[model samples]
Target chain A: MPSIDVCYSPELLHLYELEGKAVVAVDILRATSTMVTAFAHGATDIIPVMQLEECRAYAEQGCLTAAERNGIKAEGFDLGNSPFAYMNGQVKDRTVAITTTNGTRAIRMSEAAQEIIVGAFLNLEAVAQHLRELQLDVLVVCAGWKGKFNLEDTLYAGALAERLQGEFEFENDATLASLYLYHAAKDDMVTFLRQSSHVRRLENLEIHKDIEFCLQHDTYNVLPVWKRDRLVNLKEFESLGV
Target chain B: MPSIDVCYSPELLHLYELEGKAVVAVDILRATSTMVTAFAHGATDIIPVMQLEECRAYAEQGCLTAAERNGIKAEGFDLGNSPFAYMNGQVKDRTVAITTTNGTRAIRMSEAAQEIIVGAFLNLEAVAQHLRELQLDVLVVCAGWKGKFNLEDTLYAGALAERLQGEFEFENDATLASLYLYHAAKDDMVTFLRQSSHVRRLENLEIHKDIEFCLQHDTYNVLPVWKRDRLVNLKEFESLGV
Candidate 1:
């Protein structure tokens, strides 16, 4: 049986060998949630850049740019790290280049993975189904806040692990811990996460709506997968049967 | 109020600011447990060295040496990483020089902390009471398996956090997550930890007794603290009124 492991922070990514395994980069506070929302709203592809300048440069190539730093929209970027900004035709038929505090860095660091996909509570089932179809060893890499463990991303990893249960062998203590945390928070994640430092930080910024929106289960049926240079909707790609 | 945080692995210790805080280094699957037991058995002090050679060098100074690598006692060492090895007059009134794969390294890495103390289920309340008395910010450093997250140590951290609740603020998600894990495992830690990777590794070596012994709560009324170059029992030192 293929093994499932959870790496609580991207800074610890080097500990795991990523060769031939599927890596799911999760930043549920908003980056991956926003990316999944963008694809559901007709975004063509997403280029995850590490710097604000890199994201802004994509605007020259006719790609919609999203940049966030410390949970706020960066100066001169078209969008911040909010899923609401990706809806209602703002991202229709367009490509997106994005940069955020934690999420984009996780995707950039997972360059050695066999396949890298974005994961969020918004598209949890979609990511799980794709992994099941791929049938490979899976590693859920949480984009923890500032290279430290965060509650939201870990709960998302647990939710994913719970979905992939029985099919994947959780061989590490981190995965077991995550599954426990997921079960503890699954019934009322918003209330359970109210004590989280990151949640408090976001609440101080008055992005409570984003927190509630991002925590909703299976709101989007999209799997944004890494292909060559950018993330394209894998579900749509597979539907074309190419 | 001071804060309580959990650093799940020593490899991520750099992310935390340990300057004025009390760091409780916990390795529940036996290193810290052994140290606490040694102090309880009348050991004068413990010098935790990084290398086996360093620990072995202490033997020439008439100090007892204990070393373990990959869960086995190193050759020629007077003791392995087992609490039972310290009982029955083995460590009485003697200084111990110890090295371990995870625990000793965690103590060494936390050099920046204002005070470093050994924590295990064996000395849970003793360590917690010492922290309450010290009135300092606490960082529970789990000496996880090879710098990766492990279950038993995090559960120990959660147990400590639960005891210190209402006095210390849990400002990080790691602490919150650990508290949840502790609540999940508090009823029957032995059964809950059967799936832990390190527990399984030790069980393979037939150290099932060590696992059960290390998981017992408040077995020792001792707190081994770092003072100058070695760990001495803080409860005894405080009784001297020094």
Candidate 2:
């Protein structure tokens, strides 16, 4: 079996040998959740851009652009970091360009992997099953806050690591720490994360609904795979334009 | 109230503003436990050196030298990475220059901190109480395996952070995750860590007793504080000749 490891933050991305592994890019707080929500809600595609200007270019091209900095939505964008923005039929058949403080940076940094798939609690089974099918060694990359470690991302990675534990050889200490956490907090995520730094930071911003929604499990049967410069639902992306 | 934070590894030592903060350096699997045991067994002082040659210099001067590389005791050194080596009244009243794979490197890397204190499960309560006395912002630095994250170190940090939770504000996600882990595993640490990578790695190398001994709670009341280039028991280091 291939080995499964975790990169606690994007800053430690260099420590892992990710050349041929599959990278499960995670930002459970919002970015990956929003991306998974967008695809599941029938959004045509999502372009994860690292720079605000790139997202702005997409906005200028008439696509729905979302940018977030320091937990606040970017100015003049159609949507903030809210998952609800992509949840309803609003983004049906549309394209969304998202640039977030941490998630996009993680995606851009983990480009060396064989595949980069978006993951969040919203689509846990989807992402886990996708990785199971690929059967490649997995590296759960937590898009921590500005090169620092955060709880939500690591928890999400832990959930996935727990899901894939038997199939993959757990080779890193990060993997063990996270799997233990997943077992400890699996029963009550929202309550478990109540004391976490990101949740509290967002609470002050008054986004209780977003945080709650992100912690919900298996609401989407979609795995957003980054391919050819955009994130597409793995299931739908495979059949499109054939 | 001092803010409490955790650096998951010494690799992230640069992220913390350590100039005025008190650092609780942790390498729970072996190094700090060995030092605490050395102190509890009446070793006068232990010098932590990063480079093997520096440790060798102390060895040449007739001080006992202990070294470990890649989990095995280093070649021609007095002791490997075991707490038991310091027990049995072997190092009583002697000075030791000790270097290990992770712990000593973390001590040297975090020299910027106002103070560095050795922490392991063996002296968990002692270290926690010492930090409460200082009331300075605390950064629990995990001496991870070569710039990567590890389980035992993070769990020890979490244990201390949980012990001092109310006196300090939790400042980061790493801090929160670790505290939660400590709370969850408080009753049964040995079973919790049985599945971890380092334990398994060391098990194959036939050091199960070392792991079990390291995980014991507050077995040694001695607190090893780094002052003026060496680690000494905080209680007795003050009484030594100037």
Candidate 3:
């Protein structure tokens, strides 16, 4: 049986052995959520870069660019980390290059994994079902705020752990802790997450809608998976009998 | 009002600013518990060193030495990390030097704090009362297992957060998460912690008595605080009227 573990921050990723494991990089407040949303709305692929300049440079190659720093969209970028920006056919049939504070760093750091999947509450069940089929050891990497632990990503990890329970074994305490947290917050996540520091920080920035949208469960049946240089929808890819 | 934050592992301590904070270093699976027990049993002072050689070197200067690695006592040391070793007047009125895998490293890393205090369930409320009096921003550093997060230390952080709820504002999501974990585990810590990887690891090593003893709350009124070079019982120091 495969085991499920959670790395609370990208800073602590060095402590984990990522080889031959599937790494689910989640930043529920917006990054991975945005990636899943983009895939759901017919975006071709996404190149997740770590720097604003790298994201901007992709625009020369006709790829749509998105960048967020400290919860605000970087000036001159076509879109921010908000999922709403990826909607209404804005990114239809287009490639995108993106960067964000925490999410992109986590995905980039997880390059050592056998497979890297972008996970979020939007496609929670889709990711879980896909993992069940893969039967690989899963490590949920929560893209914490500024290299420290954050609540939103951890809750998403817990929800995933709960979904994969029974078939998956938890080898570490983090998975157990996350499952307990998910149980405590599942009934009323909005109220529960209102106490979170990042939620309050996002509220202060007036991105209340993004927070609400990102917390919604199973809104999309997409799986944004890394393939060499970009994230493409794995669920969509599989449905086409590829 | 002063705020409470939790650094889940000493490896992630660099993310926190410790200059003006009072750091409570907790290693509940045994290191901090043993230090509190030694102080409660009338030991004079404890010098927490990082290496076994450093701890062993103190014996030449008439100090008792205790060292543990990977949950087992290092060979030729006078004591292991078990609190039971300090009982029955064994370490009475004697200065001791100690080293362990996680706990002493956490104490040494927290040297930048205004004060560093050793905490465990054995001295839980005593440490809480001391924090309330000091009224400074507190960072509870969980001396996690080998720079990775563990359940026992995190549960201790949650227990401490729950005890200091109203007076101390939580500035981070880690504290809130810990408080919830504590609430979920407080009723039957033994059962709750049985799911923990470290507890299972310790149980495999046959230290059941140490686990049961460390989980008992407020067993001692002692506060083992770091002065310049050693940990001395602050409660005893205050009673001396110095």
Model 1 CA lDDT for position B163:
96
Ten contiguous residues with the weakest lDDT in model 1 chain A: A233-242
Give RMSD to native, each candidate: 3.2, 3.8, 3.0
Q: iRMSD per model?
A: 0.8, 1.7, 1.0
Put down candidate 2 lDDT per residue, A100-203, tens digits, no spaces.
99999889888889999898998888888888888898999999877788878888878888888778888677887787788878798888888777788889
Model 3 global lDDT (CA atoms, 0 to 1): 0.91
The candidate 3 chain B region of ten consecutive residues with least summed lDDT is: B233-242
Ranking by TM-score, best first? Answer: 3, 1, 2
DockQ value of candidate 2? 0.62
In candidate 3, what are the lDDT values of residues B44-87, reduced to their tens digit? 99999998888999999999999999999999999999998888
Off by over 4 Å in 2: A60-62, A87-90, A237-242, B88-90, B237-242
Question: Per DockQ, what order, best first?
Answer: 1, 3, 2
In model 2, what lDDT does residue B156 have?
Answer: 89
lDDT of 3 by residue, A1-242 (tens): 99999999998999999999999999998999999888888899999999988889999999999999999999999999888888878888899999999999999999999999999998999999999999999999999999999989999999999999899999698999999999999998988999988899999999888888899988888888999988988777222111
TM-score of every prediction relative to native: 0.97, 0.92, 0.97
State candidate 3's TM-score: 0.97
* Global CA lDDT computed for model 2: 0.84
